[model samples]
Target: MLTEERYAAILKLLEEKKAVSVLELTELLNSSESTIRRDLTALHRMGKLTKVHGGATSINGVYQMTEDKTSVRHNLHVEEKNRIAQCAASLVHKNDFVFLDAGTTTERMIDYLHEQDAVYVTNGIVHARKLAEKGLEAYILSGKIKAVTEAIVGTEAVHSLQRYHFSIGFFGTNGMRAGDGFSTPDIEEARVKTEAIQRCNKRYVLADPSKYNQLYSVIFADLSQAAVITTALPDKQLRSHTTVIETDLGKEQTSS
Candidate 1:
């Protein structure tokens, strides 16, 4: 097939499947893997598709500058979030000092947490309340609350985070891309997240597959800075950058 014909075929497949791997494209187009890879790279440079590890995903529909309300987000990817939360919760041990970022997935982590002896610190008001209800020791940072995501943010929150170093911290990101790393829309929240991660010995970003290959306004942490806890990694190359704990719901196994 001609290069243009191959490009058209690849685009049509992406429009239908939203993502496609080089192997799949090569077989479909009766072409070599090298040719498909070059086509994907060209398309990626042209902004026609997003080239991810082992595959290319359709360009994200929109750039989100504003965050969805907690109520709305709580309903999205519920199953994946729960699985990711379960894996994250299992990482906590007795007497560990943890920082739980305000997010739907992190909030779900509270439900699976069995470590009552671990002390928790959070900028999430709801998280703090939930932790308390579970009879876990919890502390909320002193700061201004952003109503949209219901997370505490401001210089006060950043300063409060600096005072104590946490054994582990779980964070949420609006976007996670290869080079840009983890990002959120709000600058104030990003500041708080940056400070919180800096004060932790180990950091984990709780995200679902949909969060991959997206970029937001403010970047809080680099891809290498934290291990990603997700049900599956869309991009295989991500493993070369940082640790990714893929959670299997059925077997409850994690692979890095």
Candidate 2:
């Protein structure tokens, strides 16, 4: 491929997948490894992408480097979150093993869960109590509680997740973008979220429409790792990256 064409392909991959491997790029572009490396370097120099150890990442990954208190975040997008959560909760069915990530939107999901036979494993303190009230079997991982988010995170929480794999995991992110993937500000929580996603059979991220274009410090997974359950999806690039269930418009816009 021509150098300009290779550059465009690389950026498109970063925009849709959030990250790209050098080895994969060479094969995709029908170019040499060195040529792909040079293209990535040029893009990085232009402030178009960030060069990582073995790949490139989009520059629009994170906008906020810190997480807000759960109570504060819970009130920020109340209606949008509810719609997103409801759409996500509908994915669960009886006898499913679910992983509930620690976030306000995931917490909102507690109100919409219709699966009485689903067993849950979570890292959120609030999530456990709410689960128990409904007489569902819920396990809370052991770890130091984060005061701001009221979620457990640390070595223990990360280790605990290794024991069980979920049928599907529901998550919320501090930052969202076609190029940013699912990200959060706290590295500790990011670690636990990372482990959970790895152990789960499938992943789903619950986010409000406003989350798009936002960035956080740590990316836990690529946009392709999960089907996004959100109120609206306005980014065309994002629409092509992963499956999106739009609650506001009552339409499912799916792509491969």
Candidate 3:
């Protein structure tokens, strides 16, 4: 395997096992002992893992704040995102108006929503296109499109979102906790999310377990304001403020 591929493999293993010995990594990666050592050294230097005498351990299991492109994110947690999306979409009934926040998980919501008789307002450029292709009524928010996530943000989008109240507002966040509820990396996007949350009657944040307890660049709304639809329930600390609805994704059915 290539060096980058080996590195990613090792990291994925570490994520599952938390640590791995040299023999295990070498066999798992199908590489020589010397090669595994070299890869470990390189990863250690990059601060992605901690290289010990004969193996490595993960620094922390929390998701980092780095912003990945939307395309890359779609396949990262497909099953879990779909589960969250499915549950979120179920909340919509005929003639209900919904607000969709721009993120990979939120985008997955459109896949199941194709059959729902709901009117949609969204800030995701790609989401609007997908909704339209599915023959749903979708309104794309008006504003500047963010390069990384393709989310419509800035003053115009926030102001436009405030104009309409929604029956349900579904959002995906970079991170969430009790204090910094649903947050993102950009203040402009945060503003839009904050505005939408206020305009909606029932607000829900679609965050898989991977997003819980992690903090990001800005806080949009507190946990007290919204419900959480996720595969795993949050800890007692987070549950004190927000309502968490847990769903069994049957994720093992389709994870490649």
Candidate 4:
């Protein structure tokens, strides 16, 4: 096949899978590794794709792209995430400096945090608005807005977070593997999450059972960094690594 045809085929595969590795392309195209690398470089230079260390990802293409991320944000773990959020919310103190990451689970924590005397630093636009409505001090980091998750990322977001320290941080990940660590679909979101971890004294990962033992495109922070992990029912491996806070949402809610 010609180089042009091979490149088109490569992009087609990426559209279906989101990412493609050099080894996989080599096997599929029956081409040498060096040739595949050249193609990736050329495509990246043409603004057609972004070349990562081991693979290439489509840039601004029709590969399951969504303008409104709010749809996928909710309905991930409706019941479980709400319970986990409530549990995390209970841990927040009156004057603690809390950092919240962008996730469906973490977003639910906003309602429970209402009327609290705390300063919240978050990269999530939705979370920031919720915190403001709750009468708390909310600081939304400014940077490039990621369309997929509606989270602020890029250099500005990282720089803004570096100056402040949080008492605790509540974050969520796309996937969690014992070896692969905490992963996300977008690399930009991963970068912001890494910085947030450094700016916090204590960190908690909020996720559901579905995220456990899963995988994503980018690996940001490792599971070991979590001070505590709040989930519905995590697997045994995750429990061994961190303090897993399990909650049963099905149980009747007790009045305060």
Candidate 5:
């Protein structure tokens, strides 16, 4: 099939499923992985779709960015998240107070933290447990436990977060746009993120390439609000406005 034909088919699949994986596309188009990757790259450059780990998702649609446990469990681009987590972890120093947001991307930091004298605050129940197991001072905010994502979100959590300030706060979001800013689907989640941002001395947004240019329910912060963005290849337009650090796990940080 011609490249145009393959791309058209890919777009149609994206419309139907709202997302498609490279493996799936390879099987559907009877093409090689390299060819499928190239197709995704080209389509992503045109802003027609957002690329995810092994797949792509529709850009124009009513997409809900929810914290479903099953979805998070099946999250594909974990390597990128690990890379981001490592980069985010590097910013931590001894005795620093850090607030880690609740998300799979932020959760990856649990394996990389080596600081022993740090106070780690988070609304992620799983993350708090991990921090505890690692022998760090973990503060788990009180709030409504969201079973779907195992996260705490509500006024209680937001109120609790406002009481403490952090030396650095790391957050992750569902969708981000230049004008609309960083966003999440849940209002309570957005509230917690915004509170964390305001209470921290420095703010970092942890996102994979899949999240850039997407939109959600509420805006948490703008591009200027972030000290750095650690991700895979982020959208070029978004990169132009902020300090974009591109990394493959174990590679030197390339500033874009």
Candidate 6:
């Protein structure tokens, strides 16, 4: 087949399946794996598709540059988020210093958290209040608040994270892709997350299955930098690169 014909065939298959592995494409097109990979790379450069390890996914599968309001996001994937949150909360021990990033899933974690002796610090305004309501030791960072996510972000927030190292940190991300890693839309918020991750001894990103295979503008931390806590991980290839805690298993299943 001609190169253009192969490209058309690849894109049509992607449109049908949303994602296609190089092996699948090679067999479908009666071409070599090397040829399919070259096509994928060219398509990726042209912004026609997202080239993931061993496969290619449609561009539509990726997230947008803008984030939804907190109220809107809070209603999505409630059950899955709760499962991830419970698993995250279980990891917190007494007297540990925890940094909780602002997001609906991370906020859900507060309900399951019973570590009253653990000191909590957050860039999330609502998280701070919720922690206080639970009578947990909590501190809210001082910084300019972003209205959409209601997270405190700025130089001061990053500076605040520098003062003390956290025992474990739980973060939220708008997107999680193998290449881009953990990402959020806003750069300042990403900065805060990046700083917090650097200062923590252990880090985890809490996300539902929908967050996978997505990419955003700003990358906060690399995929290998943090373990992911989720109800399910749709991408099997991702498991090979990082630690993933799948909470929906009868017991927590850790895969690296």
Model 1 stretches with alpha carbons more than 4 Å out? 1-62, 249-256
Q: How many backbone clashes does candidate 6 have?
A: 0
lDDT of 5 by residue, 66-125 (tens): 544636543656666788888888889999999998888788888899899888999998
- Encode model 2's per-residue lDDT on 1-256: one tens digit a residue: 7888888889888776665667879888888888989998899889787665456656675467876688778876576788888888888998899999988999989998878889999999999999999888899999999999999999999998988989999988876777668788899999999999888888988876546666788899898888888766655677788898888678788976
| Model 3, position 144: C-alpha lDDT score | 97
Which scores greater on TM-score, model 2 or model 5? 5
Give candidates' CA RMSD values in order: 6.8, 12.7, 8.5, 13.6, 3.2, 8.4
- In the range 51-158, model 3's lDDT, one tens digit per residue, is 654577665545445677888877665666887899888778888899989999988888878545789999999899999999898899899989899899999998
Each candidate's lDDT (Cα)? Answer: 0.85, 0.83, 0.80, 0.74, 0.78, 0.85
Question: Residue by residue across 1-256, what tens digits does model 4's lDDT show?
Answer: 8989998998888666555678889999999999999999998788676565456755532321122266765964466578788888888987899999987788899978863677888999888998888778888998999866878999988888888899999998876666667777787788899999988888888876545555677778877787444433323455566655556533322111
TM-score of 3: 0.73
In terms of lDDT, the poorest run of 10 residues in model 4 is 59-68
How do these models rank on lDDT, best leading?
6, 1, 2, 3, 5, 4
TM-scores for candidates 1 onward, in order: 0.76, 0.75, 0.73, 0.68, 0.84, 0.76
lDDT of 2 at 22: 78
Q: List ranges where model 3 is wrong by over 4 Å.
A: 1-65, 249-256
Worst 10 residues of 5 by lDDT: 247-256
Number of the top-ranking candidate, with TM-score as the measure: 5
The per-prediction tally of clashing pairs is 0, 3, 0, 0, 0, 0
Structure candidate 4, residue pairs in collision: none
The runs of at least 3 residues in candidate 5 whose Cα sits more than 4 Å from the true structure, single-residue gaps closed, are 16-24, 41-47, 50-67, 70-74, 249-256
Of candidate 3, the 10-residue stretch with the lowest lDDT total is 247-256
List model 1 lDDT by residue over 182-243, tens digit each.
88999999999999999999999998765777778999998889999887664654555677
Model 6 CA deviation exceeding 4 Å by range: 1-60, 251-256
Which candidate do you rate higher for TM-score, 2 or 6? 6
Report residue 1 deviation for candidate 1 (angstroms): 26
